[model samples]
Target: MVGDALASSPGGYLLVLAVLVPVIGMLAMPVMGLLRVRHAASLAFATIAVGVAVVGAVGWRVVGSGEALVYGIGGWSPPLGLALRADGLSAVMMAMAALVIALVALYARPQFAAAETAPGGRRAFGFWALLMGLWSALNLAFVGEDLFNLFVALELLTFAAVPLVCLDGTAATLEAALRYLVFALVGSVLYLLGVAVLYARYGTLDIGLLHELAYPDFATHAAIALMIGGLMAKAALFPLHLWLPPAHAGAPAPASAVLSALVVKAPFFIIVRLWFDVLPGASHEAAARALAMLGAAAILVCSVVALRQARLKLMIAYSTVAQVGYLFLMFQLTIEPGVPAWATIGWTGGMLQLVSHALAKAAMFLAAGLIAEALGHDRIDELAGAGRAVPVSLFAFGLAGLSLMGLPPSGGFIAKLLLLSAATLSGAWWIAVVISVGGLLAAAYVTRVLKRAMAPPPEGIVTSPVARSRELAALALALCAVALGLVPLQPFDLLAIGRAGVALP
Candidate 1:
C-alpha cells in the first residue's frame, strides 16, 4: 500500500518527487520528439498518473497522522536548508490540480491533434509541457517553506500562464498578454520588496522561522501590507482586476479554464498563508476592512458588468471576478475574536468556494468551448437553439451555472450560506447584504444564457455537433462541484488539523 511506502521512506524526497515528476516530463518532451505519437502520449499519461499517486500518498499520510509531512532538504532543518511541508490543505490542492490538469490534457488531445503531425509543430507539445510545469509550480508554491523558493515557483507559474493568454498569436490576444505581463511584473516587484524587508527584519526567509520571529512592529506591518497588496493585484481583486476579463476571455478555452480557475488562486493562497500563518495575532483591522470593501465593490460592480455582457465567455469572466471578491470576505469575517463558531464556518466556506469555483469554472469554460465549436460563435443573442444541437454541453453549462448561482445542493450554495452565517455572527451586515445581492446577480446572468439557449432559433439556424467525450468531460467536473455540497457543515477539522502547531497564530 502507499501508506507502507510512505512509512518506510526516510525523508521528504517523495514530496520533491511529486513536484519534479511533471517537470521531468516537460524536460523530456524534446527527447521524445523522435518517437511515435503514441509513445509521447503514453509518456505524458504515465507521468500524470504517477503524479496523482504521489499526491494521494502524501494526502493519506497527512490525514491519517493528523500531522504535517515535513522534509528538510540536504539533511538540514529550516533556517539553514529548505523544507517541504504537506498539510491537509496543501495535499488537497495538489490532488485537485493534478486531476484538473490530467483531464484538460485528455480533453485537449482531440482539439490539438492536428498540430501534432505538422513540421516544427511544437505549440501543442509546448502547451502540454507548460501545463505540467504550471502544475508542479503550484504544488511547490503550496508546500515550499522558504519564501525565496516560493518566489521561484510563483515566477514559474507566471511564465507558464502568460504564454497561454496569447497562444493563438492574435493581435488582440497579444495585447491582452502584454497587459497581463506588465501588471504581473509590478506585482512581482512589490512582492520581492516585501520579502527583502521581511528577511532584513527577521534574518530568515523560512515561513515557520519568520512566523515565530514576527513582531507587530512598523517594519513587519509595512512588509505585510506590501506583500498583500502585491498578491491582491495578481489575484485580480476588485479595482486591480483590469487585466482579468480580457485575458481570460481571449485565451483558448482550456487555457482560460486553467488561468481563471487555478492560476489566480495561487497568489490568493499565498496571501492567506501570510495572514493566518505568519502574522498570527496581529490585527490590521483597517487594512482588512479595505480589502473587504474592494471585495464588496467587485461583487456589486462586476456582477452588473456580467449581466450586461453580450458574449457568454466574457460574462463568465466577469462572474469570476465577482466570485473572487467573495473569497476575500472571509478575511474580514474570520479575523474577529468574539465571533461565534460560525466564524470558523467562514474559513471552511472560503476554501469550499475556492475548490468549487475551480471545478465549476473549468466545466463552464469547457462547455463554452464546445458551444463555440458547434455554433461557430459564442454570442449570447445568436445562441438560440444551441441547447438542442449540443444538449450535453448546454446541460453541463447549466449545471455549472447552478453552482455559480449558489443554488441548492451545490457547493457554491453551501459556501455562500456559510459566509452569510459568519457575517451575521460577526455583525458584518454589509457582507451579508453583498452575498445575497451577488447571488441574485449571478442568477440573472445564468438565467439569461439558459433562456436564449433553450429557445428556438429565429430562422433556419443550424449548428454543428460536439463530441460526446468532450461534453462528458465538462459534465463530470460540473457534477464534482455539485457533489462537494455533500461534505458536512462542521468546522472541517481536516483543514484545521496540522494548522494548530504551526508557528503562525
Candidate 2:
C-alpha cells in the first residue's frame, strides 16, 4: 500500500501545523515554565491567532485552486503512514473553530481568573491549556484522513472537554462531567469496534482508500452502522441526548459554548465523512431516513423541553439539542443515486446550519452567561431588568435567536430554506413539514426568553453591568451568524471545493 506520496499541495504543510500549533502551545505551557494566568492567556490567544491565520491561508489555497491540501506524513503514502488533508470543509471549520475559541477565551478570561489563594493557582492555567488542547483536537478531527487518527483526535477532544465542564470542581458539575465521560467512552468503544472491523475486513483505515475499496458486504454494512451509531451517541442527538443538557447548562458559559458550538459537531463531521464519502453505498436508504426521522424527533421534543425551562442556560442547552437535529435531516435529502452528496442543496444547507449555529449558539450562551453574572442567577422570570442592564448582550441574544428561528437575513434562514427547498423538491413532504415546525418551535422558545428579558424590572431588580469587551464578543459572533446569509442564494462554489467529479453546489 505504501507508494509514491500523493503529490503534496503548495500549502499542505500548513495542515499539519494547524493541528500541531495548539498541541505545541499546550505542551509548551509547561516546558516554557509559564503557567501563570497572564502568561497562559497570552500564549493561548497568540496560538489561536496563528491557528486562524493558518486556516485562512489553507482556505485561500483551497478556494483558489479548487482542491484539497494533502500532506502524507514523512513523504510516506497511506497504509504505511498517515496523511493530513484539508479541504474547503476543513478550512471553513478550522477557521470557525479558531474564531469561536478566541471569542470564548476572551469571554472566559475574567470568569476563570485564578485566585491568588487557590491551591497552585491552576484554575486559569487549566482553562487556557484545555482550550488549546481542544482546539488542537478539533483541527485534527476536521483534517484527519484516517479513522484511527480521527479516533485519537476524538479521544483528545473528550479528555480536554470533560475537564472544562467541571472547571469549578463542584459536585454537580463533576457528576455531569462523569456522565459525559462515560457516555462518550461508550461512543469511542463503538467507533473503535467499527474501526477494527473495517481494518480487519479491508486491511486499511484510510478514508479515501476505503471509499474505493469498500463494497456492499456484511462487514462494510455492519461497520458503517456501528460507527454511525457511535458517532450519534457522541453527537448527543435525540434519545442519546440525556447527558448534554445538564453538562452544558452546568458548565461555565465559555465551556458550554465550546462544547455546544464546536465539540459535538466534530463527531457529527466524522459521521458525515463516513456516510457520504467512505461508505455511501454500503448504507441503505432506510438508514438515512431513520437518521432524518431521529433528527425530526430531536427538533420537536427538545424544542418543547427548552420552552419549558425556567433557567436561561437550561433553555439554551436544550435548544442546542433541538438545533443539532437539523444537521441530521440533511442526510436523507442529500444522498440520492447518481448524485454526489456534496453537489446537493442539502450539503450546503446542512454545513451552513452547522457554522451558523456554532456562531449563534456561542453568542447566545455568552449572552446567557453575561445575564447570569449580572443577576447572580439565571432565573428567566427574574431576568426582567437584563435588557436595561446589559442591552448589548440582550441584543446579541435576540440577534442569535433570529438565526435559531430561521428568520430572514440570517444564516439559519438561508440554511433551513435551502433544506426545506431540497425536501420539497425531492418530494420529501414530511421533511419539509418537520423543518417548518422546527423553525416555529425554535421561535417559540427564543421569544419566551426574549419576552421575559424585555419585561421592565420588577420594583428595582438589581443587575451588574457587563464589560464592553464581553458584550462585544457576544455581538460579534451573532453578527457572523447573521452575515452568513450574504452568500448568494445560488450554489456556493467555495463550499463545493475538493469534491472531485461532483457537480458544483
Candidate 3:
C-alpha cells in the first residue's frame, strides 16, 4: 500500500523541490546583481506559490484518501536509504511555512528596497538571499527523515537565521545575535551527540527504520532524552530561553517575525518526532511529565513577564515563549490508556495551536514592526492614540491578539477547546487549569496593548504614518488564524492517515 501510494504521489518530488528550489535561488542571487534583486523577490513569491500548491494538492490527497504519501529514495527503502513522507501534519506545516514566507517577502519589499542608485548594497542582497536560504532550510527540516540529515538542516536554519538578527550590525543586535549563535551551537552539539548514540545502537538513522526496529535498550532511552532535551534548549523552553527575548526583539521587524513565528518551531517539531515517532512506547512517562512541568513553568512565568514588558516587541517575544508551553500539554493529555479513539483531538489540537500561533505571531510582530517604524520605537506606554495614526496595523494587532487569547471563531479557541476536552476526559485536571490560566494571561497582555492603542494620545505624544500594504499583509495572516477555527471538532483523521504503517505505542 505504501509503495502504491508512493508511485502515484506527486508530492514526493515536490517535497525535494520545495527544499532545493529556494536554495537554488539563493545561489543564483549574487550572479543576478543588485539591479535584479527586485526580480529575486518575484522569483521567491513564484516558487513559494508553486510549493504551496503542491502541498495543498497533497493535503487534498491525504484528506481524500486518508493515507500518507511516502517516497523511498533511490528505490532503496528505509534502513538502507533515506525516505520522505508527508502526512496531514507535514502538509499543513509546509503550506503554513510557504504562506508565511510569501507574506514576509511581500511585506519586506518596501522595507528592504534599496535605492536604484545604490541597488548593489549589502543590506538588500543579503536580506533577499538569506530569506531564500532560510526558506530552503526550513522546508528541509520539515521533511527530513534521518536524524543526521536533520541536524544538517537545523544547522542551515541557524546559519540563515543568525545573520538576519544582526543584519543591521548595530552593537546591541550584534550582541544578541552572538548570544543566539552560541546557545544554538550548544544545542546542536548535544543533539549530534544523541544522534551518534542512536546510530551506534540501531545502525540506522532513518526514523521509519528506527521505529520498525524499536530499540528498547538503555542506550535508546538515553539518546532520546538527550535529543529531546537538546531540542528543548534550542526551542527556548523556559530556563534555556535566555537567548530568545533579546535576539527576537532586537532583530529587524521582518526578521523578528520569521524568527518568532517559524524558527523556534523547527526544534520543537524535532522533539515531537523524537518522543512520538522514534521512541514511541519507550518514552519515559516520568520524563514526559518533567517536560510538561517545565512547559507549565514557562507559561506562568513568561506570561507574567510578557505582561510586564515595557516594549511591544519584547512582550510579543515573551508571549511566544508562553504559547510554546501549550504545545507540551499534549504529552499528559494524550498518553492515557482506555482513552477514547477520539482522543487524537489533543494531538490535532497541539498542531492547530502551532499553526495558528505561527500565523498570528507573525502578523503581530509585523504590525509591531510597522508601529516601530512609524514612531521610531515600540514603547507600550507611549502607544496611546497610536491606533488612530495606524488603524490598520492596530486592527491587525487586535485580530491576532484575539487568536492568542483563545476567543471564539479563532484557531486558538478551537485548539484550547480540544486540549481542555482531552484533559477532562483523561482526568488530568491540572493541564486544564494551566491551559485556562494561560488563556487568561494571554487575554490580559493582549488587552493591555489594545487599551493603550485605542486611548487618546497622551499629552506631547507624537506618531507617524505606516505603510498600508504592510499593515494589510499582517491583517491577512491574522485573518487566516481566525479562519482555521472553522475546521470541525473531531478526531482529525487526516493527521492519523499516514501513521498506520509506522509502529506506534
State TM-scores per candidate.
Answer: 0.94, 0.96, 0.93
Expressed as tens digits, the lDDT of each residue in 1-505 for candidate 2 is: 2343464566778898999999888987766554443466677778888888888888888888888888887877788878888888888898899889988888887776664236634777788889999999999999999999999999999999999999889999999999999999999999999999999999999998898898888888899899988999899999999999999999888989999999999999999899877884533678889999999999999999999998999999999999999999988988656767777888889999999999999999999999898988999877888888889999999999999999988999999999999899889999999999999999999988889888888895777777889999999999999999887775567777777765543
lDDT of each: 0.83, 0.88, 0.82
Runs with alpha carbons beyond 4 Å of true place in candidate 3: 1-11, 34-39, 115-120, 280-283, 338-343, 459-462, 501-505
Better of 1 and 3 by TM-score: 1
Residues 1-505 of candidate 3: C-alpha lDDT, one tens digit per residue = 3453433355567667767788877876665655454455555566667666766776776667666666666655667677777776677777888889888877887777773237444676677788889988888888888899899989999999999999888999999999999999999999999999988887999987788886577888888888887888789998899899999999888889899899999998888788778884633668767877888889899999999999999999999999999888777666756443224787878888899999999999999998887777899987877787788888889989988989988999999899889888878788888889999999999999999888987687677677788989999988998998999987676566676532322
In candidate 2 the C-alpha lDDT for residue 116 amounts to: 29
Q: Which is superior by lDDT, 1 or 2?
A: 2
Q: Write one digit per residue (lDDT tens) for candidate 1, span 1-505.
A: 2333322234357788888998998777767775654234456777888888888888888777777788776667768778888877787778778777777777676766544567424567767777878888988988887888888888899999999888888999999999998888898788899999999998898888887888888898888789888889899999999999999999988889899889998998888888877874546677778888899999999999999999999999999999999999888877656543223888888888888898899999999999998899999998898888889989989999988989988899888888899889879999999999999999999999999999986687877867789888888888998998888886676676567633222
Residue 200, candidate 3: alpha-carbon lDDT: 89
Highest lDDT: which candidate? 2
**Model 3 lDDT, full chain set:** 0.82
Distance (Å) between predicted and true CA of 316, model 2? Answer: 0.5
Superior by TM-score: candidate 1 or candidate 2: 2
